[model samples]
Target: MTAATGKKVLERRLPDERATARLGEDIAMALRTGDAIALVGDLGAGKTTLARGVIRAMADDVSLEVPSPTFTLVQSYETRVPLHHFDLYRLGSPSELDELGLDEMLASGAALIEWPERAGDRLPEDVVAVELTHDGEGRLARIAGSGQAYERIARSLAMRDFLTGAGRGEATRRYFTGDASARSYETVTMAGEETRVLMNSPRLVLGPPVRDGKPYAEIAHTAQSVTAFVAIGRALAGAGVSVPEIFADDLDRGFLLISHLGSEGFLDAEGRPVAERCAAAAQLLAAIHARQWPSRLEAAPGFFHDVPPFDRDAMLIEAELLVDWYVPYATARPAGEALRAGFRAAWNAAIDRLDRAEKSLVLRDFHSPNIIWRADRKGHDRLGVVDFQDALIGPSAYDVASLAMDARVSVPPEIEKTAVDAYVAARREHGGFDESSFAEAYAIMAAQRNSKILGIFVRLNERDGKPAYLKHLPRIRNYLERALAHPALAELRDFYRRNGLIGGTA
Candidate 1:
């Protein structure tokens, strides 16, 4: 297969219905809102079967019924992302598609349109054309597109090549959830082999400088590439911390095939944090903080990443997110210059105390969502950690606060105390652990983190169109109040109260 008009094209041979389904699943992983997958093929060419596979992959339910829309014209399903399955076989002309509400469907979600050729030039400009033909025993698919759709098709092909090069060419791909960041994940399974995970973290395209001539990601020390994850994962694993083992990597493309840590999370079925699991996670953090970690890490031969320290500038900028996005959200107006100045001053004063605290490799998101429990492993090794690509050299208290006052799940006051005590006791065994000062640092770090999150969640809702994070605001507010209760943060608490950001007197 070849591109006819300089557009990107990918061709694959599907030896059977299973292979066709697998290809559909891979393509589904690359689908996003506004993407239109135009399925064009001859009758009895397994187009509906391929469409079924794509729908099931996006829905993550293999049993989902996906009947052809020959009579219904269009069938819509609510999945992780909404999907419209369109069969234009019965359509008489292109203009008739306007009656199907195609524009509204594309605006809200994605579409898989079979017999799209019937729509003629009415199709969206970004449609990815998947043309299938009957092979000797199965089928051949040629995918081509332009613009963002073309880029997504190219990425899917790259992932296919990566897996093939890693000796899992025939593996089936399944979509895993993506986070608020630029990365996404998938699980790949091959016959009679242990399942593996594919971390599809493309190199970040830096935005225009937001502060100090640096992008917001660079200023905040966010991971710029998969190298950070690879480097940090190896470093942690070398120290006997449980992390997914890297099996294969395409460093240039930012793809990695890694060991699949099972789905047993630190929380239970009811979404409550288990006390024992929380304690173990705290102990794991203690073990990490007790070690001496190097500032520079080797990601690959002759390539190194220097871990940036969590400095005053980074902390202040993070806290400013509250001023940047949250203040307007809460107050219905942008923060005045005075309010911004006061906010910065309070955070600077609070961050000054971090200099006296114990510093170590801080797994920045050491919360429930990133933690997996291994029942077969011993001690801290039972805790499987992921999403540490953004780790930094910071006060140990930050991670403890992240775990104890977890943002995703509610850690009850008693459970939070138990976890905190476990960490403190474990640290004491290593000696020279200052309980009084550590408590103060924990409070400050907790307040700073929750403050940043308050703005981040709102930004995600308003700017990024992701409303799920907003649901955690009440929990984050409670955590902030708990952190503010510490006498060390009284002045900062007063500032929030004065600004009417929080209720009650300081």
Candidate 2:
């Protein structure tokens, strides 16, 4: 099948209502705010059933009641991306849709319109259309779209292929919330089998070189491909660290079917850090740091990826995000070149201290969100680590700082101190552990990480249209203040105060 827009139309054979529901859920994964889906089918053709599937999937609640909108005209759902399920069959006329305010709804969220033909010429031109027909005991679905909607359709088809290749071709797919990055996830479930997570992390495209002929990703040592995740995952598993087991993978396409680590995280339901889980996570970090890390690790046979050192350049570039985005965002003016130069010099001087500190595999984001708490496992094995693709060879204290001063959840001062003490106590067993030097490094890294996060959250809101992250800015700012209290970061603290970036000091 194909569309007039020059894009291939995807066709699927849904054997039953279950299969139809799975199809809807898969489609939901590709949906973004403002996209419209037109469901075209005859009466009792499972149109409403499929629409319910999409609503439930987006809500991440399988049991969410999604009543047919046939009577209500339209049923709107408050999902991660707001959704409006419209049944236009009872509309008095095509012009009546204007009174329903659909354009306004689509501007803010997605719309799933059933019986779109009832609207006549009022239907959106760029909408994705799913045509359903009875195929013997099963149903046949043909999906077509144009523009961004077409791209989404293509990605959905790709996801289907990936799941089929992973031996879960007929499994139901449920949309999983995505993170700050371009990566996405889905929970795939097969009858009589344990659930698995589908990680859809496509290879990052390098933008026009912005720094020394390198893109921002390269300058910041961000993972450009899934090879890093595979390699680092294997390395962690080899060391007996609790990580999700990879069941299948398409490395080039950046798809992986891994074991689900349950939804229980290190933070409680109220968003406060759990003390026991936090201590375990710190101990896990100590165990990881105790191991001798290699410069290059094998991602696959004959494929080795060199672990890039978190050198002065990477540190300085990350800190520069403050001046690059946050400064202008907070001050309404860009930093002058002299200000930028001074900022760079100050960071360089502080980051230089990392050279003399102990180095290890630094899992850059070892916070509550990424750490899964496995009560069934023992000791460090109870912590299931995820999102380590950006791991680098850097100061051991970097990961500690990441854990102790997590960005996503509030870690009270006492809890943070306990975590720090737990990590230091664990490290002391290895002998020759200098707590003082480690504390200095932790403070420096904490300040750097928080500074980077402030800018990142602002960029997410201003540039990416995601304002939810801004809620954590004050928390991050507080962490930065605490870190600056250390005398070793006195100069950096003074610099921040001088620039009026933050107030007060140790």
Candidate 3:
């Protein structure tokens, strides 16, 4: 008989049970919603041990109880990625596979089948085959598949090679967290509790043209590569900001092994803002804005990243997200040309007023989520900043507004005032501060950021299949109302109120 026609994806020699478990951990990173991975071998092969590694990694618990389902025929786990371990050795009859509910399991999550031969032709067409065979002093494991599952495995394996070059080949990899964008993170842990972050921020693949034949990412000045993060991290560090140090990097491939900052944030147990930490974050922003920043930054000796200007066009494009996504979602109808015209006109006029405002390097997202609190550190160092890749030259007050009106949490009126008052007091101490101009800029910037967020949250839910952000809509609505109260936004406030976006009838 001819050998299997499937393309072999990976071949690795597992020298011991630890190496075998590590391979399973790598495989776990590639698992998707409907994947079927067949663990093939004889009875004494390390099939059950490999499956346990996958289960334990996904569950993020080293001692998770993952007993073989040989007697029970199947055992399900409620990990981050729901998984089912199927041992079909004693499957009795092929017809009994129906009761095993492979299809039903695949409909929700993925499955790991121990005896693929017993399932016969009932196995999925896209099944990934992992065969274990006895080697001279160890076991040889082979993985093969096609379609999305194969592509994912290929990507994960490539990352493993990258890790090997970075001297973390034997480290355990598990999901750390993910954000709204394509970027995801994994915590790579070496022996003896040394941990680092593996930032998998692939070069962006922009979407279809949204305006002027340019994708929204381009118009919005989104970071196209890991260079943005690298450049900005260095820039902040030089300015005395506490940003993570990049330990290793494959910039072209968009992979970075960075220091893991502590996990403490400004939010309390109930997800509410902590005033003291927020005030500290405010002081951090003031110190940042006190200095002048260059528009271009050197990421490496020769490689450079130009920090994009938050010009009128980019500001207009961001504000229109409210018109494009939030307006329709709110009114149950697409915004007409007249409404869009009114909205853009109001925003353009407000942006025109920004030139008179003080200028500095603005971290476009200076809210609570991106700020890591380090209580052990001293003044300004207490805030460990991350996610400043989209930093731009803009009004100095924008970051102050961001902390006062955090996008993720509800900063009550008193706490919001505390943040702003702290920032104002710090800027005054730094000298050459214009309180009146800063107030005007703060109101306009707050309103502008809220408008963009209102639309982005809706877009994330409808277009990106992320509904978790939708819950923040009401909180944003209130923040928008507060920002509109400033007399500087009288005209813009009128437009929003007319559309029932805020208070007052048209």
Candidate number with greatest lDDT: 1
Best by TM-score: 1
Model 3 CA lDDT for position 137: 77
Rank the models by lDDT, top first. 1, 3, 2
Give per-residue CA lDDT, model 2, range 1-506, as digits (tens). 45456655778888999889888888888889889999999998889878988898888888998888888899998987899999998999999899998999998999999999999988778888898999999999988777887676577768788888877888877777589998888888988999889998888877778889988888888988888998999999999897889998888878889999888877887878888888889988998999899979998987677889998878888888889888897788998998898888888889877767889999999998788888888887788998899999999999998998999887889999999999999999978788888988999899999999988999999999998998988888899999999998888888899987888321
> How does residue 385 of candidate 1 score in lDDT?
94
lDDT of 1 at 437: 87
Task: Give me the runs in candidate 3 sitting further than 4 Å from their true place.
Answer: 1-8, 90-104, 117-127, 146-148, 504-506
RMSD of each: 2.4, 2.6, 2.8
Worst lDDT 10-window in candidate 2: 1-10
**TM-scores of all candidate predictions against the true structure:** 0.94, 0.92, 0.92
Candidate 3's residue-wise lDDT over 320-422, tens digit each?
Answer: 9999999899889999999989888889899988889998999998988788888898998888887888888888888888889999988999999999999
Task: Judging by TM-score, tell me the better candidate of 1 and 3.
Answer: 1
Off by over 4 Å in 1: 1-7, 13-18, 44-46, 59-65, 133-140, 504-506
Q: Which RMSD does model 2 reach against the true structure?
A: 2.6
For candidate 1, the 10 contiguous residues with the lowest summed lDDT are 1-10
Better of 1 and 3 by lDDT: 1
Deviation in Å, model 3, residue 119 alpha carbon: 4.7
Q: Count the backbone clashes (under 3 Å) in each candidate.
A: 0, 0, 0
Kindly indicate the candidate among 2 and 3 with the higher lDDT.
Answer: 3
